[model samples]
Target: MKQVEIISGGPELLDIVEPLWAKLNEYHKKRSTHFSHKFEQLTFEKRKQNLLKEACDVTINLIVDQTNNAYVGYCICTVNKEKQGEIDSLFIENEYRKYGLGAELINRSITWLENYQAQTIVIGVSEGNEHALDFYQKFGFYKRRYILERE
Candidate 1:
């Protein structure tokens, strides 16, 4: 059995998540029915830049396998000055997904966001990724509305 730990930080740690983020992008690409092209275009650098530009406060929680010295999962939470919170991203390595890593990451992020006095919190799951709806609902994230985008 491997020991696990969670590390916390801000934008300074963004580089560490690139590989994990890329794996997430590939996951979406495979599951997507209509937006694989969008995922294909979403490079980690571009996504990182967007996060840097938009988020006023950021919390990145990384789940590490201490013995293996590996980052098995991560979640990014952001809060703006207006107290709007977002679970910007989350991913766990395929093998690690069965270990409840995703739920742990979300719980940590939600607690952090609440600590910041966030009035409204949100999460955006890609169109073809509705399979995660049940998982997210466990965290009190129910769909309020949907914004359909055109091709």
Candidate 2:
């Protein structure tokens, strides 16, 4: 974890973040008690397209480990036409998890969203990853609502 740096950019960073995003998708798949199949169908390109929708503003921040010149984590932030903000996706490499990278990622991203005047910011945590609830709580994100789908 030596020589760590955080870089920020727009949609062009999407391709750069794909591998890390894939790992995050797998994590969600394993932890999702009911939506594993939903994740199975989610590909990087598909997800990118979702983010590219015309109505929202997108920004990404990546944590790079200069020691090996590798990207260890990334956070994606978005704000829609309605000024609704979202910390849409966040992940830190398993090797990088215990070192506070995730917290830094969310903090910087949320600050960016706030600077953009985000009216409301939210993060959608998949079910079964409830272990992260406490982490999100530290950033002042609490469970205000949960939507269940009939399967």
Candidate 3:
């Protein structure tokens, strides 16, 4: 068995997560036709800046393989002044999917938000991703809104 560590940090951690982040963007693009944002348009420096801005209001957690010092998953969550919490992103490497790491990431994010007194928590699932929807549903999340869009 391997030991997994969860570390919390701000955008400065992006340097360690960049490769996995790129893979995450690609994964999203491949999963949805509407996910047409040209991630390539942003240079890494700009992306890091954007992440820094986002981190100002959110908590970012990274799951690492302690032995090899590699990041294998991440979760980002934010709690608003209204006491509402939003899970901005969560992803785990494909090879790591079956080991419950994603669930652990989510559990930690939820606990962090609850500690801040969040009254409600929400997670957005891409329209066509049933697996993600089901995953969140398992945690007692239910549909609250429909964001229909046309290209």
lDDT per model vs. reference: 0.90, 0.90, 0.75
Candidate 3 lDDT by residue in tens digits, 92-116? 8877788888888888888988887
- Report the backbone clash tally of model 1: 0
Give the candidate order by descending TM-score: 2, 1, 3
Query: Quick one: ranking by lDDT, best first?
Result: 2, 1, 3
TM-scores of all candidate predictions against the true structure:
0.96, 0.96, 0.82
User: How many steric clashes does model 2 contain?
Assistant: 0
What CA RMSD would you report for each candidate? Answer: 1.1, 1.1, 2.5
lDDT of 2 by residue, 31-52 (tens): 8888899889999999999888
In angstroms, the error of model 1 at 11 is 0.8
Weakest ten-residue segment in model 2 by summed lDDT: 49-58
User: How far off is residue 64 in model 1, in Å?
Assistant: 1.1
Which regions of candidate 3 are displaced past 4 Å? 37-56
